[model samples]
Structures are given as structure tokens and as C-alpha cells.
Target: MRRSLIGGVLLAIALYLGAGTLLFAFQRSLLYFPQPRAIGGPDRLLMLPVTDQQIAVTVRPLASSKALIYFGGNAEDVSRSLPDFAEAFPDHALYLLHYRGFGDSTGRPTEAAILHDALKLFDKVSALHSEVAVVGRSLGSGVAIHLASQRRVARLVLVTPYNSILELAQRQFPIFPVRWMLQDKYESWRYVPAIAVPTLLIVAERDEVIPRWSSEKLFAQFRSGVARREVIVGAGHNDIGGRPEYLSLIRSGI
Candidate 1:
């Protein structure tokens, strides 16, 4: 009986260790759902230097002094956003980033790599434009929050944003130690206090991914008078773009 009990204990420990190893190895893979280069036609795609490889950006370039830089969701194809943006902001040049591995961009996706690329992209846009507005949705909210805190962003908009990927992950995988396993924490709450630009946070009325409280908590972290949080009546995490109020809020913020 003693040996059987000892064997069961050992087996449980081994299973736990194995699960942890797998979680650590493929954490980023679980987070990033990369899609193929969907923005067809040669003219729509633009390449920019990021490390050694040319990162793909969906550009709606105009000879305008104002530009808008959009960082999409983790699994988003930014090419789809071009039409809506062009209709809304005709005078502003539009740049939508496809993260490494998401489109034609090379290398694997990582938080450090995406943040590095965002900084480079923002610098390039800033050189030619006077006022640059930034929009980040879902996962991109983390990138946008970080960029707005570091750079001179004119206006900031986040759709279905979270306080941090860490907190969200912890809630999703309650049995696991997500805080220890996660490689990309994406703690937007940390960046909120330093952000000085006028900000708009659009929340889904029924967000099935990011909990409403998580966004509210992040909104609360913003310096006293810097941000306004609005809710879209009938939208979820992915479908918030379809809401007319969502676009209106974005237009007003810009």
C-alpha cells in the first residue's frame, strides 16, 4: 500500500511538471494567432525595415500632414480596416501594422519584437506627419498604450482593451500559475499613468474575452483627466467595429 501511494504521488508530480513545460514552451503560440497575408494586390502592401526583414504594413497613404497608426488585434488582418478608415479620416494618412508572422513580415512574434517594431513604425510616421493618432484593439491596446506613453501621440483609442494580459490570462486559466508561465505580460495598467494624450476607451457591452472590470480598472489607472470610457450597446470583443457608436466615438476622439 505504501509503495502504491508513493507511486501515485510521483506520477502526479511528473504530470504537473510536464504540463508546466508545455505551457512555458508554447505560451506565445497560444497568445498569437497568426493569419496569412490577406491584403491582396501589390499596391496595398508597404514594407518597412524592422531588424533584417521588411515588415508589412497596410498603407492608405495620402499627402496629408496628419496620420493615423493602427495596431490591430492579436488575430486581426489589418487590411480589412483600410476601407473604414479611409471613409472616416479622408485627410489623414493611414498605416496599419501586421505583426511579425501575421502577414508577410518575417520572424516569430514576441512582445519585445512587436514593441520594437511599433517604435520604429511610429518614428517613421512622425517624420512626415505633424499629428499622429494611434488606435489599438484587443491585443494591440497593449502596444498602443505603451507607444502613447513613450511617444508624442496626438489621440489614443483602444477597443475592448484590457489592463494587462497577465490579469486576463490568470482569470482564463485559473488552475495554472499564469503569472509565472506567461512570457508576454502586456501590462497596460503600468503604462497608463504616464500617458498624457487625450484618450478614448471603447468597451463592448458584452465582451466575451476581456472582462468589463478589467477594462474599467485600466481606465481608472489613467491620470485623472486624460481618458473617457464608452460602452457599445450590442457588441462583443470581435464585433465592436460594426457598432455605429463605436465609429462615432473614434471619429470624435480623432
Candidate 2:
């Protein structure tokens, strides 16, 4: 019986090691990836040069007191939706950020890398535009929240955002030590309460990627007079931005 117990313990150790190795190997897959595109057409995607990296930003001018800066979800090529976004806010200057290692941007993607690049982009935009409103979708929401917490933004919009990535990782990988294993812990929940700008959170009732409750939890923490929450009915994570009602809500909120 002792020998059998020893054998079982060894087998369990082997299994644990193997599982950890596999998770580490495919960590990139856990991130969102999207193809990059330019504004207007494939030939016109402009590259904005930063101190450390060159980011692909789709720019369009709209007539408003504020400028619109959008950050896409994980693995999303923010430049892909530039044309529509440009059309949406034709009068305000629209700036879409390509995260590190995404769409013409340089360097490998990591939590710190993304945040650093985002700060650089913010500084660049802030230098030129006096009033800047930020929008973050899904993974980008974390970036937007962090920026708003630190900087003075005119408005903030989060689509399909969550309380924290750590919470989502825990739910998806209950058996694994996801919180410790994750290198990009975009902890928005800790920063959201500090944001003082007008914040609008758009939650999809039927979002498949991020559950509605997670968004509600984040929304609950916001007690500022400018904070508001809206739900898009029959919309999922990917399609929520395409709906007319969603666009209307965004326009009205801003």
C-alpha cells in the first residue's frame, strides 16, 4: 500500500508539470488577435511614430469640442475598424491605437508594454488635442480605464468590459493557477473607482466572451455623477458595436 501511494504521488506531480508546461506554451492564444487595416482603404493606413515604436493609427476629423481615441479588444487590429469609426465621428479627430505587437506596431505584446505604449500614445494625442474622450472595447477597456484614472479625459466609454482580467482568468481556468501564471494582469477594477470623467459602460445582455455580471460588478463601483450604464439587448460581444441602438447610445452618451 505504501508503494502504491508513492506511485500515485509521482504520477500526480508529472501531470501537474505537464499541464503547467502546456499552459505556458499557449499563453499567447489566451490573448485576442485581430488583423490590422488602414483607414479609408488598405493603402492608406498611417503609421504614427513614437519614441520606442511606430503605431498604426487611423485618423479622421470630426466637428466636436472633444477628440475621440479608441482602443480595441485583445488581439483586435484597431485599424480594421477605422473607416466606420471615422464615419461615426467625422468632425472630431479620431485616433485608434494599435497595441504593441499589433498592426504595424513594434515590440512583443505584454501587460507593461501595452500600458507603456498607451501612455505614449495618450501623451501624443494630448499634446495636439485639448479635449480627448477615450473609448475601450473588451480588452482595451482595461487600457482605457487605466488611462482615465491617471489623465484628465473628457469622457470614457467601455464596451463589454469586465471588473478585472484576473477574475475572468479564474473563472475560465478554475483548476489552474491562472492569476499567478498570467503575465498581463490588466487590473481595471482597482483603478475604475478613481476615474473622475464622465464614464459610460455599454454591456451586452448576451455577451458570450464577458458575462454581464462581471460588467455590472465594475459598473457598481462607479459612484460619480457622470457615470452611466446601458445594456444592448440581443447583442453579443463582437456584434454589439454594429447595432444601430448601440451607436445611438454612444452618440448620446458622448
Candidate 3:
């Protein structure tokens, strides 16, 4: 009986180590769900040369000094939001990025790579526009926060934001050491204190993916009076964008 118990303990340890190994091997596949662009044409597309890859930007060009640059969720195709944004902000030029692997962009998505691309996009947009505002949703919120911290953004908005992807991963896989394995530990809270621009955080009242506490924790990290939080009643994580007040709140922020 003692031998059987010892054997069981050994098996459990082996299984645990195997699971962690598998998780680390395919972690990026689990985090990013690359989606094809739904709306695109030569007139609406901007090919940004980044390193060896050409990143695609869905654009609505305007001869104006005000512009908006948007970063989207892991599984999102940002081009879909172009119509609504164009209608809402007629005076502003719009640029929506397709992350490294998403849409027509080449290369794989990583936290560092995405942040670098965002900075490059910002530099390009700011060169033409005197005032540039930034918006990020879900996974992209981390990108936006990081960019805002490092750049001169006139206004900022984050939807369904989280304190860190590491915290979320820890909650999901409590049995594993997510902190050690998660390569893209998007810790938005780390950059919040450096954000000097006026910021708005839009939360879904019933966010199924991101816990309310996570978003609230990020909000609390912002310097006092630098950020405002708004909750959309009866909204879920995915459907919050469909809420009537969604674009209006965004409009108010930028």
C-alpha cells in the first residue's frame, strides 16, 4: 500500500510538470486569436513598413490636424469599427491597427512587438496631426496604456481593461505557475501612473471575461483625477461595443 501511494505521488508530479511544459510551449496560440479583416480596400488600407513585416492599418484619411489611433482585442478585426468611428468623429482622421498576426499584417503577435508597432504608428500619426487620441479595447488596452505612458497622447480610452494578463491567467490556471510561463504579461497598472493625458475607462457591467475587480484595480492605479471609470449597465464583455452609449462615451473621452 505504501508503494502504491508513492507511485501515485510520483505520477502526479510528472503530470504537473508535463502540463506546465505544454502550457509554456503553446501559450501565444492560446492568447491571440488572429482574425481576418472584414473591411478593406486599397483606398482604406495603409501598409506600414515595420522591421521586415508590413503592418496593415485600416484608415479613413482626412485633411485634419486631429486624429484617432485604435488598438483592438486579441481576437478582434479592428477594421469593423471604422464605419461607426467615421460617423461619430467626422472631423478626425482614423487609423485602426491590425496586430502583427491579425488582419493583413505579417508576423506573430507578442507583447513587445505590439508595443513597438504601436509606438511607430503613433509617431507616424503625430507627425501629420497636431492632436492625436488613442483608444484600446480588451488586450489592446495594455498596448494603449503602454503607448500613452511613453508618448504624448492628447486623450486616451480603454475598454474592458485589466490590471494584468498575468493576474487573469493565474485565476484561470490556478494549478500552474502562470507568472513564470506567461510571456505577454500585459501589466497595464505598471504604466498607469505615468499617463498624464485625460483618460476614460469603459467597463461592461457584466464582463464575463475580465473580472470587475481587475478593471477597478487598474482604474485605482491612475494618478488621482487622471482617469474616470464608466460602467455600462447590462453589458457583457463582448457585447459592450454594441451598447448605445459605447461610442458616445468614447466621443466624450476624446
Cα RMSD, each candidate: 1.2, 2.2, 0.7
The stretch of ten residues in a row with the least summed lDDT in candidate 2 is 36-45
lDDT per residue (tens digit) for residues 1-254 in model 2: 99999999999999998998888777766675645554455444557676677777666654456688888888677766676766667667888887766777776677787777777778878887888889999999999999998888889999999998888888888888887888777888889778888899999999999999999999988876858999998999998878988767776656
As a TM-score, model 3 comes out at 0.99
Candidate 1 global lDDT: 0.91
List runs of model 3 lying over 4 Å from the truth: none
Q: Report residue 68 deviation for candidate 3 (angstroms).
A: 0.3
Compared with the true structure, the alpha-carbon lDDT of candidate 2 equals 0.81
lDDT of 1 by residue, 1-254 (tens): 99999999999999988988998898888899987766556787788888687788999878899999999999989888888898999999999999998888888889999999999999999999999999999999999999998999999999899999999888887878888889899999998899999999999989999989999999999988899999998789988898777778998889
For all candidates, the clash counts are: 0, 10, 0
User: Against the true structure, whose TM-score is highest?
Assistant: 3
Cα deviation at 223, candidate 2, in Å, is: 2.2
Flag clash pairs in model 3: none
**TM-score of each prediction:** 0.97, 0.91, 0.99
Tell me the spans in candidate 2 whose CA falls farther than 4 Å from its real position.
1-5, 38-46, 61-65
